[model samples]
Target chain A: MFFHKYKYGLLQTIRNKELTFWALGFTIILGTLFYAAFGNVYENDDIFEAIPVAVVENVGDDGFMQLLTELSQGEDKMLVVNKTDREKAEELLGNGDVEAIITVDESIALSINSTSDSISVSIVGSIVNEYNTKSALFEEIAKTNPEKLPQAIEAMNVNIDNVIKEHKLTDAPMNPYTDYFYNLIAMGILFGSTFGMTIAINSQGNLSAIAARKCVSPAKKSMSAIADILAAVTIVFACSVITILYVKYVLGVELGDRLGMYILTALFGSIMSVSLGYAVGSVGSIGEKAKGAILLTVTLLGGFLSGLMSHGMRQIVESKVPFINRVNPAAILTDAFFSLTVYPHYDRYIRSIIGMAVITVICTVAGIIMTRRKKYASL
Target chain B: MQAFNLAFKILKKNLGAVCMYFGIFFTMVILMTKFNPTDAFTTTKLTIAVRDLDNTTASQMLVEWIGENHDVAEADFDNEDEMLASLYYKEYDYAITIDKGFSEKLANGETDGLFTVSTSPVSYTTAFFDSQLSSFVSNVNCYVAGGFDVDEAVSKTAQSVTAAADINSLDGNEESPDAFEYYRFLGFVLVVIMISALSAVLMTMFKKEVLARTYCSTVSDTKYVMQVILACSVIALGIWLFIVAVSMVFDPQTVFSRTGVLIIINSFVYMIITVEISVVIALLVKNRSAVDMCSNVIGLGMGFLCGVFVPSFMMDESVLMVGKFLPAFWYNRALEIATSSYEQIYNAKDFATCIGVQLLFIVTLMAAILVVIRSKRQQKSL
Candidate 1:
């Protein structure tokens, strides 16, 4: 009987070409998107390449010219493009060609007339971040007396390690590629609920269909509701399976926890998501407006709590109104994934289970009530 | 006229469904608009620690000053080990420790005030914490001199001065972004979303028996096709305006002069492209589920891929090239440029290209759907 009902549902869904195309398209696009998004595409290193710089030696000093030559030919440096033209430098900013440009004047240190302190501050701050190197040999000589010159040379080289140490900060390693599985959780909920609601509404409303046939027979309303729920659950289950399999096998998304927890989240998530569809449609007055409002609200709120948007928004939300964070499904799913990555404890893990359960109960009850409501008109 | 008559019936019958969709759009508009665009660039989780062992009045005042400022709002551990542990664990941003001789050294006008602040030297956010330290220093320097003027020489040569960076940033020709630009984006998003939903609605309305029956009737096929487009447009435009009005409530800084006329014209062009996309979906798919499923994949997925979800600027180089091909991408790109510093660069030529691309997609997709409809799927119902 279950197999027969399943076949009927399949036949009913596939008869529509648009629906089939969407199913296939998501399997391709989202499959690829999730695959690509979940994949580790970027592996960042601290090496600089293609540094943009401009040179102008107005003082005509051999030492300054030598410094410029060394900068241009430095092996560790990536100055492939020497943008000496001011017009070209300004154009580069608009074209998104480079993050910044370093323009060197001949009297770079001494010439007060040509200086724009504001431009220097902005330019130098950016330069320090990218280059992470600083040298002022002449300034050091000008400040101190001439008598202790030989000894001071030895002392200056002694403090060279401090200059090297400043740049050394870039090397001490940690995972620079931030994990974004919270986004996956948000996608799952959005996909599951949208898919579930559509199928559930159609399955239930067309009582002349298989579900209605079951309702008229020895099968009770509860049994029929259960069957519909099961069908919806199957949809979410398939969706999660697709997500996990694609995310893990194809996309190489880190599931942090073992497959067991991933499976658990999917099941609980699917159940809640499917029930939400029934709850929405069962209200006897569920319109496209309400569904849209709920879906968008859930997507944004869920996506936000999962740290999908700007980090500031996420931090402010988490550190401030932590209570809302507790109820948010995106936060719960994120916390579950975060649990596997950050902590092995089940405290947050159990909270996800509890939250899914509450959503399940609420949605299930709403569905039951809607199914029990009398239809005033039929097509 | 027949299309309009039947369109009203379809809309009235699906009143519940229509209202739900509108509700969702309005809700999203409200949420997106309420967030302050000003604070989007502000850095997060900044913390400062003042380890004053002597605990004098001056020390307390310095500590209190840090406490009052929102920049150092989350200051944590008082002890060295505690602060270090938190810093390592990434709890606090940075730690500033003032030694016992800090007050005495500063009061004497001596340059030997030994204050050391430890930060994860690698963290890019260290500069943010360092800026707070500069503010503290300049304030103290002025306090000692019986005036608030920080010595100009020290200010110029200092490797890290907060006021210096602030002034530098101010000197640049920073454009003030109007809220209407964001609203225009919201308008584009709504147009696409509604189109997607309508595609699904069209597919679901299809039934095999109904299609076969329609084939046996005397109704002109082109007229029926026209009805679908007409109905979808009427409904979609309603959605577009409702979203616009709802979105506008959150942004009252309306530039309501002649520019409002320009905005209206842009909205008209955008709506035309939306109708075309909707028509393409209507003709391409016949099942309800397929309409929705395909619409989402095309609408939401492409919307994101085409740089709808996150701005295209933050996107990596490789994906950005692919994004340029999408119609929605051009729609957003044009919208962004029109409302940004690129107003001069985004001349009439580029604007024409963006509008041209969307129109081309609509025309091309519609033609393809028509060919498919006539050759194989003629026995259809709408």
Candidate 2:
């Protein structure tokens, strides 16, 4: 009897339209939002653009061209400004048009002139500052000892010679792209639909209340458990597919890595949500309170832990309880996307699949235990 | 006053939903601040490429000192051009090239060598390299003064000094933090976006089945409109204060004092913007689902484009320019200037420009709302 009621409850939820609409709507909205939110830190634009520095050389020697050539490469975009002389370079620096100006003194040591106000430019100035340091040291040593100048210049020449031979490495990660909203939408649709479906289950099949009524007639316990699990899984999978499709098509959020992983992760995530819903629905006397509490908890907890709340709160969580980042299913899902995109070798993706799977099982068992414990009052 | 009384009555009648609305907004505030960490720790030796010209004992000692103190990345630079190229591009912060006169110059009792560091982290990077250079130079001077072997004396005299900041203030709370940009004022933006949406969603749910009966009869349209505006304004102001206060709770610097006053003003401007959005949802969309959909369209959509949910850097130039037109973006800009020392670069007067733009949006949106409401009433009367 319990088996029939549980099985029937799952089918009725499948036929519900209102819940389906919300699930899809949320999935699209959340997915798009999520896709935009994460991956933003890395602005994927052209690389190798040099900080535009105005050069003012009293010598006008061709040697400086080598420095300019090495820095700018074939890209004219890097060194956007090359003033004719010091006066122009200084003018541009004073006006803030140029980030920094490199003025070479008669002695070969360089000096960087810029309004000290800009920290980023000042840092750029430091690199220029080093060139001055080199020239000054070279001039001072050669003038005093003369012998060391040839050797030092020779070493510098050799270092320059090796530039092409030596490999330059940049380990900047690939765009750690993710959308908070997409994940939120995906999780919310799964969770919200399942929560909504609990209402459907009660309205359609008074499964728990009717279970005890039929207990006297006769029903196997194992069959009852199977029915409940099957119903919840069916509801989870159906809602997940509709919501996932809406998330993909309408919102245009990037779905990374294996499509199978996304479905699998969301499935377990939904099972947990519904299992919690079932546990709450098992509150016999006042179902509304249970429903409200369950919905509120799912949305708030999911939002808070997963950084759906805001950057400020996310910062606080990361600083104070960084581990909350690990446990959050929404965080797990989003991180998995990032890992696949950025850290192809990162362990987080594997962890997400395993963690969510474990959670699904736990939720399923809890839902079964709570829903089937035979509401003492109903008995 | 009558409008306010009506609004108060409506709100009083619906407290549970109001809390839920407030709860989500508050949670957004908490989440935004929590996401970024304020940590100050030393990273293990950042690889530094060295091109020793002299290769003398003094030069070797200088290189050895660098290896001991910092992770000196052994990079081969056959020439000055290669080293300069790498430093300019940030492959290395500072590079050392020992000039030819090193042994003779040191023997001559003059401390002269060149240390080059980029301008990017001029403060931290310059200070660090400066200290190391000073120590190495002083050791060379000592050896020259006393005819000492460079390596043995330099290593023996070198002291490992660690820097510690006395951040425990009189107020007991630390001001700002190390790596101020790391938290990336962008977090605050995410908080405001989520808050506006959450508040809108929660507020939407307040339009229950029975409000239609009250909305249709007895209450004059003037009273109804006035009451709604009043209720929204009050709720909006209340939410604004709560958000600002919560913002103040973290980032105590620039968040309080005269800056806090600026935040208080901008908070109203922003919350009013949010409340107007919420009001539109309540007036038009009766269904919870519809309300949520509309709110997401305006709140989330605008937030996405306007540098709230995502930083403007990630946005396309055209999209970012469009985002500049939104009141929320300007409002946050006002808050940003008020709360950070960026006010030093672009002061309060500049921030007022953003405020001016935001006001323009409020007026425009309010005007649109008024026009819609007036047209709806005329249609009903006809």
Best by TM-score: 1
* Local distance difference test, each candidate: 0.50, 0.51
Q: Which candidate wins on DockQ?
A: 1
Predict model 1's lDDT versus the native.
Answer: 0.50
Q: Per-residue lDDT tens digits of candidate 1, residues B1-382?
A: 5544655665566565456545654555445455534312121335565556647666565665555442453444444433433443455555665567655654543333345566664343454344344434433433333321223222322332222211122114334244444544544355546555565445433445544565566756666657766777677777767655653554444435333433444565666666666656666665555555655566555555655554555455566577666666766656654544322243667766776776786677667767866765555432
Find the candidate with the highest lDDT and give its number: 2
**Candidate 2 positional error at A25, Å:** 2.6
lDDT of 2 by residue, B1-382 (tens): 5545655554555555555545654554445445533222122244566777777776677677677756675445664433433443345655556667765655655553443332222224533454345534543444334334445434433432222111111112222331123223332333334334434433533344334665667877567656655556566566556555555656566565676567666666665566555555555654555654565566565666666655454556666576676766686566556644222233868778877887787888788768866876688679
Worst 10 residues of 1 chain B by lDDT: B162-171
Calculate each model's fnat, 2 decimals.
0.02, 0.04
> What are the chain B TM-scores of all models?
0.69, 0.53
Assess the local accuracy of residue B39 in candidate 2 as a C-alpha lDDT between 0 and 100: 20
Candidate 2 on A116-167: residue-level lDDT in tens? 2223343344344434444544554556656555554543433221111122
Give DockQ for candidates 1 onward, in order: 0.10, 0.06
Predicted structure 2, TM vs. truth: 0.62
Interface RMSD of each: 10.9, 12.5
